[model samples]
Target: MKLTIQRHQKGKSYEETFDVASLKVTTLLAALYEIKAKMDESLTFDAGCRSGVCGACALRVNGRETLACSYTPHDGDRIEPLNYHPVQRDLKVDKEKPQETLKRVLPTTIQNPKSKIQNPPLSSEDEAKFRVQTDCILCDSCYSACPVLAVNPDFLGPFALTRAWRYHTDPRYIEEVPNDSIQHLTSKIQNPVLLDTVQQNGIWDCTLCGECTAVCPQQIDPKSDIMQLRGESLKAGYSDPTLSTPSFGTPDFGGGFGFDPNAGF
Candidate 1:
C-alpha cells in the first residue's frame, strides 16, 4: 500500500509518498511508523496512548478529522495534520492556541460561597445533564471541523463552550439558595463564567453546522450543548443580533437543504 503524507517545515508544505507493501501496516499510525522507520526517518506525526483514549494522535485522514491510532489504512490514503492550528511539523499541529482557549475558559466550578457549600444530594436529572460532557478528550477534532473558526478566530470553539455549559448547568451552579431565594448563580460571582459565552463572539456566533459533533471521537455533542447554552443565555436577557423575526410562508428563508418538510420547495 502507498501512503501520501503532507509534510510541513518552516512554512512550506509538500507531499511525500511511501510504499509500505512489505510492512505489516494496518492502522494509519502503524503505517506512519513504518514510513519513519524504513523509508524516511524525517517523517513526523503525533501519537500517544495508541489506544484512542488520549486523543493525542489526531489527524486529517483523507480529509476527515480522525485519530490515526484507530483508523485503518487503505491504498493511496492521504494523511495530514488538523486544520485551524499552526502546523509544527509534518502531521503535527501546535495545540497551544486551543489549549490556551480551553485554559482561558476555566471550565471548572466558579469560585463562590454557594459553590463551596456542603454537598447537596444531586438528582439524577442534574447528574445526567453533564454526564456526556465528561467524556470530552480535548482531541480538538471538533475544533478543526468547526467552520466558525475559519471566519471568527475569536469565537470560543465547541469544546470550550461545551465545558462552559457543563459548568453552568451543574447542580451547584444553578441550584437555589437555601433560605431567601437569591439571584441566579451568574449574579453571585464577581465575574459570571456564563457571561463569557454570551458576548459578540460567543454562543450566538455558532452556525450550528454540526461538524463539531460529526468529528468528535468521544461522541460528545458540543453543538447540542451550545444550543442549551444559548437557551440559558436567553434566560439571562442576552439576545443574538443575528436572530430576527420569523419570516413565515417564505420557502427559501431558512429552509434547510434536503427534502423539505413542508414539501413546497
Candidate 2:
C-alpha cells in the first residue's frame, strides 16, 4: 500500500510518500513503523500502548481525526498532524496548548460544600451523572475536529468544557454544607464562579456542532456535556449572551399585516 504523509521539519513543511507491503489488517501505525524502519529513518510520529487506549498516536487520516494504532490504512491514504495544534514534527502535534484549557477551567480538586464531612459519600446515581465524561482519554480528536477552534483560538474547546461540566455536576460539589459555620452556609450554594468562567469563549461560544462528539474516539459526548453545562448555567441565573441581545426578539407589527401596507415598497 502507498501512504502519503505530510511532514514538517525545521521550519518547513512537505509531503513524502512511501510504499509498504501491508496485510489487510495492518494498522496505520504499523505502516508508519515500516516506513520509518526501512524507508526513511527521519519519519516521525507519536505512539504508545500500540492499542487505541493510549490515544498518543492520534492524527489526521484523510482529513479526519483517528487513532493511528487502530485504523487500517488504505492505499493513497494521506496522513497529517492533528488540526488546530502546532506540529512538533511529522505527524506529531503539541497537545500542551490545547490541554491547558482544562487547568484554566477546572478547579485543582473537587471542593466539597459539606466541609464538616470529609470524603463525602457519592452514590451510584451520582457517579452515573458524569460517568461517561470521565472516559475522556485526552486523544484531542475532538479538539482536532472542533470548528470553534478554527475561528476562536481562545475558545475553551470541547474536552475542557466537558470536564468543566463533569466537575460542576458532581454531587460532592453541590451537597449542602452544615450550618455549623456562617462561611459554610454562604458556600452551600452552587459554584457561580465556574459558571461565570465558562460563559465567555466557553459553553456559550460552542455552536452545538456535534463534530466533537462524532470524532471522539472514546465515545464521550462532549457536545451533550456542553449542553448540560448550558442548562446548569441557566439554573444558576446565567443567560446566553447571544440570546440576551436586543436584536434577538421578534419585531412588533402594530396589530397590522407583518409589514405596513401604507409604506411604499
Candidate 3:
C-alpha cells in the first residue's frame, strides 16, 4: 500500500511517500512504526498505550481527525497531523494548548457539598448522569474537528465544554436533601466550578455543527453535552449572549405598510 505523509517542523511542511506493501500491517500506526524501525528511523510521530486508551496517536487520515492507533489505513491514504494545533514535528502536534483549555475548566471535583450521603447506593438514574462523559479519552479528535477553532483560536472547544458539563452535573457537586427542594432549585454557590463555564468563550460559542460528535472515537457527543450545559447555564441564571437581544416583534405598519392611502403614488 502507498501512503502519503504530510510532515512539518519549524514552520516548514512537506510530503513524503512510502511503499508498505511488504509489511502488510492493518493499522496506520503499525505501518508507521514498521517504517520507522526498518526504513527511516528519523520519522517523527506520537504513540502511547497503543490500545487507543492514551489518545496520544491522534492525527488526520484523509483530512479527518482520527486515532492513528485505531484507524485502518487504506491504499494511497494521506496522513497528517491534527488541525488547530501547532505541529511540533512530523505527525506530532503541541498538546499543551488543548491541555490548557481543559485545565481552565477544572476537571476535578471542587468542594463536594455533602460530607456524607444518607443513601449509600447511587440510583441507576443518578449513575447515568456522568456515565457518557467518563468515556472521553481526551483524544482531541473533537478539538481538531471543531470548525469554531478554525476561526476563533481562543474558543474553548468541545472537549473542554463537555468536561465542564460533566463536572457541573456530577452528584458529588450537589447537596442532596432528598425532598427538601426541587432538583433545579439547588443552590450553585456551594460549588464554584459549575459556574466557571458561564463566562465568555463558554457554551454559547458552539455552533452545534455536530462535527465534534462525528469525529469522537469514544462516541462521546460533546456537541450534545454542550447543549445540555447551555440548559444548565440558563437554569443557573446565566443567559446566552444571543438570547439577550431585544425582539422588535414584527414591525407594525398600519394600512398597507410602506405606502399611505392619503398620499398619491
lDDT of 2 by residue, 36-142 (tens): 88788999899999978889999999999999998999889999999999998998889999999998776435556456678777889989988999888999999
Candidate 3, 155: how far from true, in Å? 1.1
Across 42-97, the per-residue lDDT of candidate 1 in tens digits comes to: 88788899999999999998889999989999988888899888998999889888
Q: Give the count of colliding residue pairs in each prediction.
A: 0, 0, 0
lDDT of 3: 0.79
Query: All models: lDDT?
Result: 0.79, 0.82, 0.79
Error of 1 at 165 (Å): 1.1
* Top candidate when judged by lDDT against the true structure: 2
What CA root-mean-square deviation does each model show from the true structure? 6.7, 5.0, 5.9
Model 3 alpha-carbon miss at residue 176, Å: 15
Error of 3 at 185 (Å): 10
Instruction: Give the winner by TM-score.
Output: 2
Stretch of 10 with least lDDT, candidate 3:
175-184
Better of 1 and 2 by lDDT: 2
Error of 1 at 58 (Å): 0.3
